[model samples]
Target: MCGVGGIFFKSAEHGAKTGEIAYRILDGIYRRGPDSTGVALWHDNADGLLYVGVNCEAPGGGGRILEALDQLGTVKQATDGDGYIRAAIAYGGSEEDLVDAIDALDPAITVSSVGRHLEVLKHMGGVANLDAKFDLKSYDGRLAMGLTRYATESRIDFTNGQPLSARAVPGLAVMHNGHITNYHHLRSSYALKGYNFSTQNDSEVIPIMLIDEMSKGATFEDALNITVDKLDGCFTYIAVTDDCFAVVKDAYAAKPTVVAENDEFVALSSDPQSLREGVLSDIEVWEPGAGEVHVWQM
Candidate 1:
């Protein structure tokens, strides 16, 4: 089993801290997923720099990455966290080329996200370990999603964690609970089309399929709606783009999903206690109907 949570601030003035709340939510659901935890955050970036998230474990990987990125453009800021590196680069270049260049640095290197407003961070172990390394409490953003993963099929590693993003679709990230029944079939189809997946986990397919649909000119919401029909499984997923936040459940709603909302923000989690613990205490919480989709745009 896995635990997923999302928080979308209704206004920047809400005075909400994304990282602190994300910690509470994931910690509340720690028992459900004690193996690993991750988070994807979106914030306003007026500087026009692309935020690139890469997983690199090679010796001197940080220096190598900076050297390579400087060859293309100026790297404004880059920070290391465990095995991940988040860099802000001012470059007018193809996202594919940037990611490919980074991935070629080492066999262990994988680009998790490249976007204007998105930063994906994950680590094996508990939420505290993740916070110790990335300092999650300092992040203040418009929307963010957190996940605590319990490995069922894939190996328990940094790259196999949730909150996976599509390398081809910048500013898009997904966190899911439950399993995808048609994962292998979908993986084969997408792989045959030259799509590269960084992990063997089934949840990784969610973002890949969404990227495929969005590439065909479907809006983010339309792509998600189409995904609901194409995927055969019992799952509840939350997704975010540059301007939107979405939550979706399978037709049967076999996985648990609870939501809480108020004038300031909206929150979702696999456990209701997580909502109460991370969000508001005296607010009402509800569940979406089977196959239901809820989206909020900024």
Candidate 2:
């Protein structure tokens, strides 16, 4: 099992202290997933922007990822570490541009949620290490979500970490709890459609499925409903977009998910304690029904 928590602010400049909020919330759930921690912060900008978490392994690996980014275009800032680098890239670039840039330096690297309003950053480490290395303690943004992983199906590396994104579709990111038993079959089907999967883990298949539906003109809600209907196992998933947030539970609802909201924000997590610390402390909390779709506006 993993811990996922997030808060959506009404404005990009709301002075919400997102980093501290995320830290407290995630720290509260540290015991649920002590293996690694990841966070994705989103804010509104005229240019459209996203910040992703990166893990670097080679001596100059972080620099190499930055160098490649320079060739692609202007990058705001980048943070590097033993095996990861988190950076911000300008939106509006073609999918090929980003894929080629990251591939040129490290084909093993993955860029998540390449959308106008979503940027993801995640890696393998504890909350304190991630905060210190990435300066998450001071990060301020409009919308942010964080995950601490326990590494169930996938290896404990950046590639198999939480907060997976849809590279071709900006402003779309996903965090999940529970397993997808039908992953292999779904992967095969998507492979035939020219969609490449980066990890063998079933969670990686989610973004591809949602992205495909969204591309066909389905709204985020529509896409999610259709996707959840097809899923064959116990699972609860939270997906975020620039303007919307949704939580989907399988027919069995075997996994846990708590949702609470107010006029200011909407929050969800695998447990109530994280939500208590992260977003609202006194709001009524409830478990979503099986085969339910909970949607809210940002």
Candidate 3:
């Protein structure tokens, strides 16, 4: 089974602590998906213009990415992380425009995440090798989610990894466990509606379908509820947006999930063991009922 886990702070906390905790949570669920790891985080820079996390394949977070984005707008802040470059670009443009421009400059550059408050980092490796490519402990944000991908229906590659953000809207992120039996049917429908897809993984559609509903003016919760009814599968998904964190299960309640929360933090995992490994021993934990929905605002 694939592993999906998330930790959301009720308020913005110290970046280092937040990052460190994210790592711990991933460690708890490491066994669930040892093939690839993905983490998505949200933080605001207090600017009206959206600040994107540029995860380009530039050698040394170099001038190539800067040159490409320079055509769009100024680079306000940039950093060379474990194995990716993170940058904030100032541009009053759509996310598609920014990503397409970067691809034009360097086809190797993958915009892993784009949003005013979101950053996604992932690579083709396991928990044993994750630290070499990413330092999620250094990532800071009000909320975060990580997934360990155990490839089933899709090929094993970095591009197919989970914690996938929507193509049209990058701020929303989804981490799912279990298979989507009707993935092809749903993907076909989205294709007919002109929604482009990047991977064959069943989990990828969760964010795309969820985004489609939100684009139509549905609140995140309402969109999630609608998605549950539309998708036919025994799956569970954890969603994190700029404003809130949520967990929703399929109607059958086939997948496993546990939640633990106190005044300071809220943690979710595919199993109770993960919750124990990720959070303090004193926190109360319980299982969510079938088709249940739980959400906490950041």
Candidate 4:
């Protein structure tokens, strides 16, 4: 089993609180999935600058990454961490092309996420260890989603972690629990259409599928509803964009999920205990029905 948690702040000013609560939620469910931890956050970026998070393990990787970024556009800021680097770039080109250019630098370097308002950080360990390395509680954003993975099918590594983003679609990321039984079929179909997948994990398909549907004129909510019918799996997932946070489940709803909401914020977790541990009082809690789709906007 895996654990997933998402919190959305109704007010944009609660950036600090966003990081604190995300830590609590992950801490509550770390036992369910101690293999790896990942978090993705979305905030306000009015200037349309892309925040790119990448993982590089090669020697002198940080310098190489920065040099690559310089070739692409103006590097506004770059910060290095353990096995990871986040760069803010002012590029007036396509997000997809930017990601592709960075990905070609070295096989050891892959763009974890790239969006105007998104930042993703992940590690191959528990939540506390991840926090110790990156000080995750200090991360500030408007909405956030995190995952503790059990590594059922994919290799246990930093790149295979959850909170995976779509290469073709900016400002979209997904975290999920439970397995996709027909993942190979779906992967083949998308590959035939020239969609590239970075990892072999099943969770990666959710964001790509959503991007495909949205490219075909489907709304985010409508794309999720269509996914319930198209994906033959017993999974539940949370997808987020710059201004929206959404939760969806398959027809079976085999994986556990609970949600708590109030006027200030909405929180979801793989189990109710996480909400209790993460959220304060005065929130209404309930379980979403099978195949339900709920969305909240920031």
Candidate 5:
């Protein structure tokens, strides 16, 4: 099993670093998944230009990705760890524009995440070790989602980690905690429509499925409704956008999930026990019924 969790600051008054908050929740459930941890944070730089983080095994190997960045616009800023690198892309084009350009650089270059406000970073380590590489504490934003992998569906590299971004739609990230039984059918269908699959993991399709529906002008909720009907699985997944946070549980409850909300924030984790760690202990906790959708709109 994998640990999927996220936290959204509902009130602008709360200026806490959302990535750190997401890390805390994800760390709480670290026992559930210790293979690798990934996080997505939403933040709009003062320039109004979009920032996207592209990651590969090492910063040295990312020279090709860097060259593609030059063609986009300007590389405003960049950073890296042992094997992961992030660049602030200032392209007037859609978020997918940056992603596609990076994908064109090399097959190994994974567009970790792209958004006007969100950046995705993940690596091959646990909650305790991963944070030492990148500074999640400074990742201030409105929404963040993350996952710790148990390596159920794919290899344990950083590229195969959770919080997979949807290539067709930027600013959309998905974290899944269980297997999808009908993933091959769905994957084949999306591939036919020009949606590329970059990972072997079944959960990556969740965000792709959502973004596909979203491209048709479907609301976030409507897209999820279609996802529930189209995919067959026992899973609890969470999705994040610049404007809203959504959590959906499969009818079979194949995976566990718990939610706690207050005026300031909405917190979700794999289980109630993890939700209590460094979170709002005073608030009430409950499980969304199977097939239930609990959404908090910003």
Candidate 6:
């Protein structure tokens, strides 16, 4: 089992406290999957452009990928953690251009998500490791989502981590719980479409499929429905973007998902303990319906 959780906030309304709120929400679920933890936050500047990035793994190969990116543009900030690395690039270019540059820099370097207000990153390790390594507390953003993973398929190292992102689809990142039995078949299908696979974990297949559907002009809701229909297994998945956030449970509903929200904010997690510890001390919490797809927009 894995622990997944996220929060969607009206950045304009919450203003500066958004990052703190997001962090607390993520911190709540640290016990669910202590193997690794990561977060994605979204926010807009006065210019109205979105800023997004994630904290995740740096393929089997090391700093060569990051060094190449630094050569192309300026590497704003970079930090090394146990089995992971977190970095930021200050590029005055399009997200697509930056993503292309990152990919070109190293085939292993992938953009987890991009949006007017979101960025995400994740990799194998404890929350403390990610925090000390990345200095996450100082990060500033609007809305954010994070995950702590205990791998079921791939190795329990940096390669198999959560907050898997869909770079091809701007502003999309996913965290999943449970297994996708038909993952091999799905992986082959996407491979034929030119989407490469990295980690052997089934969760990696999610972003590729989501990006493919989005490329075909599917809305987040549409993509969610299609994903539930296509993937064969028991799962509870969460996806976040600059403008929206969604949670979908498989048809069989074998996995658990609880949602808590009020006028100020909305939070979701695999269990209530995290919500209680990380978010609000006293809040109403309810389990989502079976085959349910919950969406929140900022």
Could you estimate the TM-score for every candidate?
A: 0.95, 0.91, 0.87, 0.94, 0.92, 0.84
- Using lDDT as the measure, the top candidate is 1
How well is each residue in 46-110 modelled by candidate 2, as lDDT tens digits? 66554544445445677777777767766786777556676666645686567645755656665
lDDT of 3 by residue, 1-298 (tens): 8888867777665333665666777777777887788877777768855555444444554567767776788887765554455677788888898876665665545565677777676765654355555556666666767888888988776557777776647668788888888999989998899887756678878898888898899988899898789888788889888778789999888988888887777888886776776665656788887778888887
lDDT of each: 0.85, 0.73, 0.74, 0.83, 0.77, 0.69
Which candidate achieves the best TM-score against the true structure? 1
What stretches of model 1 exceed 4 Å from their correct place? none
**Cα lDDT of model 5 by residue, 100-219, tens digit:** 777766666777777777677787777656677777766666777788888877887767887887764667788888889899988999999988877788998999888889889998
Total clashing pairs in model 2: 13
Worst 10 residues of 3 by lDDT: 53-62
lDDT of 3 at 145: 79
Candidate with the larger TM-score of 1 and 3: 1
Q: Which ten residues in a row are the worst by lDDT in model 2?
A: 49-58
> What is candidate 6's TM-score against the reference?
0.84
Please provide, for model 4 over 20-132, each residue's C-alpha lDDT reduced to its tens digit, 9 standing for 90 to 100: 88899988889889998888888577777788888776656878888888788989888776677778888888877877887888897888888878778787778887787
- Which sequence of candidate numbers ranks them by TM-score, best first? 1, 4, 5, 2, 3, 6
Query: lDDT, candidate 4, residue 233?
Result: 77
Candidate order by lDDT, decreasing, is: 1, 4, 5, 3, 2, 6
